[model samples]
Target: MRAYLIAAVLLALAIPVRGQAYMTDSGRAEFDSRVPLHTFTGTSDVLVGRISLPDSTVDFYLDLETLDTGIGKRDKDMKKTLETDTYPFAEFFGKLVSPFDPAGGTQPAVVRGTFTIHGHSQALEVTGTLEPTDDGLRLQAAWELNLDDYEIKPPKLLVMKVDPVQQMRISALLLPESESGT
Candidate 1:
């Protein structure tokens, strides 16, 4: 009887008590860079992310090669400039720093984490909105980053140089584990 009780307690401990974790592999991430002569955008829909409702933890990552700016030549140049061969991915891993109710509708939250790019990592805090949905949650955030901070050289076209600072946007629809099909 004692052994059976112990087994039952262990099983209970192994089960997730809070809300389920959600994830998706087709999330979107994009950046817009504006120069005096031109403005362009690069986007990637291969972002992989996970959000654990139990712990309010968030993690996201994507391949550098997945970014497309609509121009093949420019995309190739970006890949080489970003040193995709050396640092193939950009990632963020952190926990929610603000109050979050997974079932309480949309709310603002701050996520504190390490943002890694171009082989460099920096501590960052991003503010975004979290909205609960039937399947899971939708997260959206916009932030700015300076190229020099990551040792990334700004690209130039002839005499026109891209801005050292660029605006970044992220939008992801997270599906619960059961709906993730994995």
Candidate 2:
């Protein structure tokens, strides 16, 4: 009788709640840099941190070693040049600056946050569209970043041949806190 009661309680708890949310371990974080001489593309592992949906606060961790751009030598060069040993990770802590009401439909909001890279932090305003999906909240935004701001020097072979401009775009599936159970 005790076991039966325990199972019943668990089933009750498993029932779908209004604010349930879920997170994916395979979340993607990518960045690209295009110059007149060469182009650089890489991906980072999106590590999930604390997330909120109702109030719109979220945090993300990006593993620095996970940067992969197909070429092995370029990846190695980045790690050595950027000094990833000192900064193992980059992070973003942000909140939806505008009110988001998913129940009404697609919520238009700006996620104002600070992105830390290579021990340097920069205030960023990611302007984008956010919508509710069956899995979680999908945030799509394309933002450009300067390597120099984070003290990252663009790799060059001919000394003056490479441009230091880097462009980055990010799309994240932010899971709801209620469903995450954290």
Off by over 4 Å in 1: 1-7, 17-19
lDDT digits (tens) for residues 14-67 of candidate 1: 576323788889999999988787899999999999988778789999998999
Q: Scored by Cα lDDT, where does model 2 land?
A: 0.70
Best by lDDT: 1
How many residue pairs clash per model?
Answer: 0, 1
Whole-model lDDT values for every prediction: 0.89, 0.70
Stretches of candidate 2 exceeding 4 Å from the true structure: 1-24, 45-50, 159-162, 178-182
User: Candidate 1 — worst ten consecutive residues by lDDT sum?
Assistant: 10-19
Error of 1 at 51 (Å): 0.5
User: Which candidate should be chosen as best, given TM-score against the real structure?
Assistant: 1
Candidate 2 structure quality by residue, lDDT tens digits, 1-182: 99999999877766533244434444577787675666768876555554465456757677778889899987887788778899877777898688777665576668789989889999988776777787677766667777788888756665434455566666667676555544
Q: Over all chains combined, what TM-score does candidate 2 have?
A: 0.76
Could you tell me the lDDT of residue 125 within candidate 1? Answer: 92
